[model samples]
Target: MNKTVNQKAWFLVLPVLLLVAFSAVIPLMTVVNYSVQDTFGNNQFFWAGLEWFEEMLNDDRMWGALGRQLMFSGIILLIQVPLGVFVALNMPKKGFWASFCLVFMSLPLLIPWNVVGTIWQVFGRVDIGLLGHTLAALGIEYNYTSDPFAAWVTIIVMDVWHWTSLVALLAYAGLQSIPDAYYQAAKIDQASRWKVFRFIELPKMMGVLMIAILLRFMDSFMIYTEPFVVTGGGPGSTTTLLSIDLVKMALGQFDLGPAAAFSLMYFLVILLISWVFYTVMINLDKREG
Candidate 1:
């Protein structure tokens, strides 16, 4: 006898579909409408077609911000992934220590994004903050608000501190999912630490590592709050990534049409890159299988 498929599952999914439509789909459509239209002083909208998009495409400031965003994201990924893997590899496997470590690792992720920015903002102050005061006492100039390199370093370090835990946790979960037989097999082969990790652990952790990479890349590309709070995109826009620039254009300058166009383009870049990542991941899975 053939087993019947569940016909009632769609009924259970209908509420979720409605919620997604109302929440994400509706807002996105509104944004698309704004991107292609112009609004006057009295709140009347006129169809502008691709006027804003053309202007944005030719704008030097947008390109600069995009470049900076790419560099920041690259640096963050290069630093975090390897370091996180190392930390995860060294963490205790089981016991109260493991639970305690896991809880501690998750603490940073639980904090609100704005609050994380605020904490780092005050924490980096030169006078009252421990980091600034210590650096100043050592006769080093440590003002992120003035110096470009200093501002970059401050934001990079702040991001590393806030997000590295997420990578570590994902790596840890991947490591934990491995069977003990893999380790025993490696030992029987007289595998070194590097060999064990390279041959056995890395392949097993590939899925979660991809997830970690994707998460980190997306978050880094769209980052605004922490760096905004810490450096305020100061020192001659040295740290002004795309998100910060978009906010400045829309809110600070009150430029409606260009800002809307900028946001749409920005969203498209993210969507395209994320799609590429998904496709590559699918192919990798197929190859491995």
Candidate 2:
């Protein structure tokens, strides 16, 4: 006997397919069109072919922005992943405190990105802001606007404060999923703290950690608005990550062709990194299985 597949289920998925095409594919097509052509106002477009792509590839500024973006993402992963794991380890397993902690941890994630940036912008000011006033009183010169180093530090710290909680919460959920029986088995084996984690908890949490890293990497690579609102890509282009540079090309400079090429390259870099991360994670899962 031959078996028939359910064809009607596709109907249920049609709306979602349409939505994604509209939201993602349509915008991507627009970018692709712009990437290969130049318009000299009045909708008069000239074929530029790969000229913009070549220019962007040769641009020192593009390379610098990419370097800065990678650095930012690397630092964020280093800081947030460990910190999140630590926080999860220390959190109460079950009780009102757990509930309270969950709510508190989620508060940062709840805030809008732009609002978070604005808050940090004010919070970092040398006058009227608590951090600024305290640092000033302590005889330290700190100004994100005028100092490149300060601007970099401020953006890194701000991102950490905003997004670390997400990693912590995901890690906590992963920890909670580990059975109590595992801990009991570890105790019976006379396992040390390191052994328990290395053998049991760490393995279990690997999936969630991969997810957290992937999310943070993508976000950091594409981060705009927040850093843009805060630094405005000032202090000598220190914080001009790819996204910032792309915007500057698009709106600031009004060079649509170059901007389009920059954006396509930017998208490809993210896609490549994400693919690598996903492949590694899939392989790890296979090994563990």
Candidate 3:
């Protein structure tokens, strides 16, 4: 006999669906409309078809921004993932110190993104900021505003300081989930530290590690307010990522059509990479199961 489906659950979900439509779907539809049309003030819109998309594709500035974005994200993953895992591995697994460490590690994550950026921006000032003043006193030329390399380093270090704790916390949770039996077994087997990690802990942490990678990748890829506040996309656009460029197009330049198209493409890139990461994560989970 076939079981009857519980249709009443739909009632509970209806309000959430409506809210999502209002909050997300409506705005997305507006972006789609702008992507295909051009307006020259007076509320008059002309059909532009894919002209804006084509222009964005051909724009060297957009491409440069994309390159910078990818490089930033790549560097973040390279630095944060390994560093986070290492920190997690070294953290106390249990006790009073563990609780203290958890609270301390969470401090950076608790800070708002804009506030973090502002803090760094002020903290890097050569005349007053400790970091800048120390570097200056040491006779090292350090200026984030004028030097492209310094700006990039500042942003990268700022991001690392801000987000690395997230990865560490996640990895720590993953490590905590592993049973003591595994370590006991490793000890009985005369396994080395590296061997135990490779054979037991690393494999167990794979799920959370994948999650950390995906999260950091998406955040780093779409980063805006922090770097914008810190660098203002300056030193000759060296630190300008796609989000900054899109804002400049939409608000700064008031070119809605191109900005909308650029945003859609930007959304697609994030969606595509996220899908790839999700697929890998799912496959890994399946294999473990």
Candidate 4:
């Protein structure tokens, strides 16, 4: 049977395709162009083929920033995933309380990124901020502006507070999708709580958990605004992640070629890591299935 295929859907999608090309593709092409070429005054450009990439690869500053970025992302994942799942497990399963909890959990995610940073920046002031004042009263030597450890702790805690709810909500949705029959079967089999979670709920939530992990990984890796506002990559660049370093190179120093190269490499690293994560998770899912 030869039936004519409907081609009308292409028309509807054309705008989005054009928009992506204009927004993402064009800018990427510009970056690539800038990466291999050097510019002087009056918009003059000359080929420097691979020089910038080589320099960036050998730069200690870039490596340090990358290490910090990786560490931050790793810490966020380690803390948020388990914490989010635990919160999800404890949340009300139904009724008005469930609705209320969902709304409350969503509140942190609603604030804009820069605004969240600003809120934390003010909230951590030693003289006036509630957190700082309370800590001071307790004889705690907490000062994010001067102490690297304190700065790191503040950013990590802020991130966990802001994003854990996202993981919880995703896990909750996965939980909601599970049929009651599974629980009934587990109950009939006299499965313990741990057994039920291990043999059923955890498996069911794996798909959403993978999603949560990837989303959190990418966001944390590229994180800029919040930490920048709060710490300004300060305490002697102890918190200077890749994005902040790149911005400093590009705009702060006007090193366009190196910055462009740095950005492209940054993009590639994220893409490569994300691919690995996706591949591993998909394989794990298949093995479990």
Which candidate number has the best TM-score? 3
**Which segments of candidate 4 are over 4 A away from where they belong?**
1-13, 281-289
* Cα shift from native, residue 156, model 1 (Å): 0.8
Worst 10 residues of 3 by lDDT: 37-46
lDDT tens digits, residue span 1-289, model 1: 9999989878988989899999988887887887788886477789999999999999999999999999999999999999999999999999999999999999999998889888878888897888888999999999888889888998999889999999999999999999999999999999999999999999988988998999999999999988888888988999999999999988898777888899989999999999988888887788888
Model 3 C-alpha lDDT per residue in residues 1-289, reported as the tens digit of each score: 9999999988999999999999998999999999999988677899999999999999998899999999999999999999999999999989999999999999999999999999999889898888888889999999999999999999999999999999999999999999999999999999999999899989999999999999999999999999999999988899999999889989998899999999999999999999999999999999999
- Candidate 2's residue-wise lDDT over 44-125, tens digit each? 7899999999998999999999999999999989999999999999999999999999999999999999999999999989
After TM-score superposition, the amount by which residue 156's alpha carbon in candidate 3 deviates from its true location, in angstroms, is: 0.3
Top of the candidates by lDDT: 4
Candidate 1's C-alpha runs over 4 A off are: 1-12
Clashes of 3: 0
- Report model 3's TM-score to 2 decimal places: 0.95
| Model 2 ranges with Cα > 4 A deviation | 1-12
TM per prediction: 0.93, 0.95, 0.95, 0.94
Better of 1 and 4 by TM-score: 4
Instruction: Give lDDT for model 2.
Output: 0.92
Candidate number that wins on TM-score, 1 or 3: 3
If candidate 4 were superposed on the true structure by all CA atoms, what would the RMSD be?
2.4
Candidate 1 lands at a TM-score of: 0.93
Number of backbone-clashing residue pairs for each candidate, in the order shown: 0, 0, 0, 0
lDDT of each: 0.91, 0.92, 0.95, 0.96
